[model samples]
Target: MSTPGGQWRNRETFVREGDGIVDLLTCKWAREHEYRLTKEVWAFRENRIAVHFAYEWHDEKGRWFRSCGNENWESDENGLMRRRVASINDLPIDIGASLFHWPQGRLPDDHHPGLSVLGL
Candidate 1:
C-alpha cells in the first residue's frame, strides 16, 4: 500500500511489502477496542476500484472514534492489488453513540443499513 510520504520510482510507488504489511494490520487490530468496519460505497472500472469506508473503535481509555476513509486500489493482471492509496479522518464520538450494533463479525448484508442510510 502506498500511503502518504510514498515515492514513485519506475512507475511503482513505495509499498509495505510482505511482513511489513502484515505487521501494520496486526498492530492496528491489536490496539483498537471493538473495531468494526462498514463499507459505505464502491466504484469500479477497468482494473481499478475506489472504496469509501467507515469504521468505529474505542481506545483503551474508552474514548470512541468514527474513522472515515477513501481507498483507491489498482489490481494486477492476476487480480491482486498492486497499489492502494488511502485517505482517512477520525471524529470523536460519545460512548453510547455507536450505530453498529451487530455481532462481532461480518455485518449481515440483508439486515444492516449502510452509511448513507444511517446518515453517517
Candidate 2:
C-alpha cells in the first residue's frame, strides 16, 4: 500500500502476509475512544470502486484528529479486493469539534447527518 511516507509492505509478520499492517492499526486505533469512520462518497464500475471517506479519532494522549482520504479498490474474479490504494491527510481539531458523536462503533443511519449535511 502507498502512504504519505512512501510505499509500504510488512517486514515484521510471521503469519499473516499483512499482519503487521493490522498490528499497526490495532495499536493506534483499537483502544481509541472516538475512532469513527464515515463514508462520504462512492463510485463503482465492474470490478473497481472508488471511495471518499473521513474519520475522526483521538490518540492515547487525547489529541483529536480528522482524517480524510480517498481509496481505490480493484477486485478479482472472486469479488475480493485484489489491490487497494489510498491517499490520506490528517488534520488536528479541537476535542469538542468532532462531527461524529453518535454511539461509538456503528452509526445509526436513520438519525445521523452525513458528511454533506454536517459540512465536513
Q: What are the lDDT figures for the candidates, one per model?
A: 0.72, 0.68
Question: Over the stretch 1-120, how does candidate 1's per-residue lDDT look in tens digits?
Answer: 443332222112233555555565666777678988888548899988888888898888889989887878777676766666777788999968888888888888887888888876
Best by lDDT: 1
lDDT at 49 for candidate 1?
Answer: 89
- Clashing residue pairs in candidate 2 are none
Candidate 1: RMSD to truth: 5.3
Pairing residues by index, what is the TM-score of model 2? 0.75
Instruction: Give the least accurate 10-residue stretch of model 1, judged by summed lDDT.
Output: 4-13
Clashing pairs in 1: none
- Top candidate on TM-score is 1
lDDT of 1 at 64: 92
Q: Estimate, for each residue in 28-96, the C-alpha lDDT of model 2 and write its tens digit.
A: 556455788888647899987888888898877888889887877666676655556667788999978
